[model samples]
Target: MKNEDQAAMLLLGVGGGGCRLAASVRAVYGAGLHAVGVDTDALANRNAAAGGMTCLLLGGSRLSGHGTGGDAIQGRLAAQDDMQNLQAQMNGVRTAVVMACLGGGTGGGSTPEIVKALGEMGIATVCFVTMPFGFEGQARRKEAERVLPMIEESADSLVVVPLDDLLKDAGEDLMLENAVNIAEGIIAAGITLLWRLLSKPGFISLDAEKLHTMVMRGGNALFGCGSAAGDDRAIKSVAALRGCSLLRSGEALKRANALMLGILAGSDLRLAEVGEVMCEVNKSCKPGCHVEMGTVFDPAYEGRIELVALAFESWTAAVMAVPKSETEVAAEPPVADVIPARVGGRKVRSKGGSKLSFGATGRGKFKGVEPTLYNNQDLDVPTFIRRGIRLER
Candidate 1:
């Protein structure tokens, strides 16, 4: 990749697990990768820094270099306190890939806040978060679930990786530590494929601009990869991808609105193999689903083929709004004719000129207090009443 392209992108790691994941990706990606890690634990921050990532300590004064100790509230507060420091690292970045593991304090609590802040800065964010394993207990799982919506609200594209599903594909007989490492390795390798697709020389390139556009319109995404060698390597790799739990056994592809497929193989890759891979993938997806494919050739991948895919479930078209002509505007239909109103548990046709308004309703107990205004709307009033929605009897 060009220096300008590298400068425009950032790989951000949040909390300890996130930092480790980022470090792993960096190791695979080699040099010229812009990376940073943030955590409430000073020791963890130092460790990430030791791995060549720029580290920032969150809640330094309040937490006193100690971690949140599983308290998500503290993690949230720490992020709030050091948010300015984090922003300082985002000097020239236009896109960020965030890595965080939910169910813990720093990852769960701070991720939403960080993503929100990045959005406000006009930076597009793609967040990859792992849900805790079931054995981790209900509390952690609940915490992760609660934090998910918050992160989704701010992230341009959200990819949720459930550790349980990830580990299930690995094997049942592995040790705990080894299983965790392998899971991380798998995720890191997938991310590395994406980076390589952008950075490495390719027969067909997937540029950063294409990624930015797709991500901005792609809401929720699914990422998975598979590799195979020897005869029919391309077809076999795609078959393995079909069985990947991360993609819900190829169900994600069937339901996807858009797909970004990357193929990495050696110079010996055949044109027929590429055609076959595309043919099989096209058959799996719905008609007219937006698809982008790129291929990279590397000598190291001789006799092997690896496929990485990102499926976007909620992809929207980038249609530009065209101003209506004066004649067309004059012939516009009435709002009542276009939008049906729901009344008495059913849709009802209303007269075109009928106006619906809700006057100020008296507050129950705090009637005399100043109204709580949000965006110039009174928050003190009932939401439905404020919006002039007629409730069913």
Candidate 2:
């Protein structure tokens, strides 16, 4: 597959918080893409480089000390710095995607700033970020609560993933690495959808403006399978998805491509039943077309069965690659390669270890919140959080 549009990927991370995220993006999508690291802490730059992000900078003000007084001020200043830098990067790219850990030091703080800058420059921005797990603590939660709204308000479209909920299946025995894998899987799933629409041959290849429009309209449409208590079986239904409305909304699930199916089962469901459900789902789709099947289950539920499906158009589908070897390379250094080796920038610092004083600022606001995080309070509780940019409220 070959991509005709010039796309630039900006990988932002602060400290080791963004390490796995940056690494995950590289692991799934390889070289010829630019990667830049940003952090006020030197460690973040070092780790991002190790993770394969080429550019690392220390533009965000470093967080020091403790307590939650006016610490938000420093965050606002950091956000401002991030916005300035991001504006410079949006120079020639038609599409820009940023992958970062939302509840940490650098990435968390500067992400909103960058988004605001891009928004002002008319560049489309999509963010893939994780919230802190409930068990982390209040500090993280407060931090997340404070910054998330600010960040969400600035971006064209924001996709906030709740890792704790997504990986609950990993169970109590899960390790940190396992948690990371789960996060990456969620990230991969989100990006893969976009990649399919833009990179494939049959789907629509969206530009920055169109991308931004969809994002502002709540870009992602989610589907999941779940079973209820008392049902001792798995249910699979074959339904043809007929339409092209989804693709127009940046969802990319049309009728011409293979159908997207989902499965859900309860504790009582037998292995045979599960097998039968999957087989039926596979057979329900159009022949000779590719099908992407997703599944989920809960052992505690007594009797439950769930199946979901979506479709995509063939003409608008894309299967293109970065075309690193063929596309004419840019003369200037790619944004990914510009992150500093160490975390030290000309950004302002706070007086006390806990906060900084950014002379003056403005108000900030987000039109509509996405379903992934903003609308669900149960999911909104910040498991982790770090501060960044500030603007007019």
Task: Give lDDT tens digits, candidate 2, residues 256-362.
Answer: 34444444344455667656555655554445545544444435234655443333332111121122332443343322322222111111111123332222231
Model 2 lDDT at residue 313: 35
Q: Output the number of the lDDT-best candidate.
A: 1
Q: How close is candidate 1 to the true structure, as a TM-score?
A: 0.80
Instruction: Please write out the lDDT profile of model 1 over residues 240-314, one tens digit for every residue.
Output: 888888899999989887888888788989999999888888887888877778887767778998888989876
Off by over 4 Å in 2: 1-4, 8-16, 60-75, 201-216, 219-393
C-alpha lDDT of residue 323 in model 1: 37
Which parts of model 1 are misplaced by more than 4 Å? 198-201, 205-208, 298-300, 319-393
Report backbone clashes per prediction: 0, 51
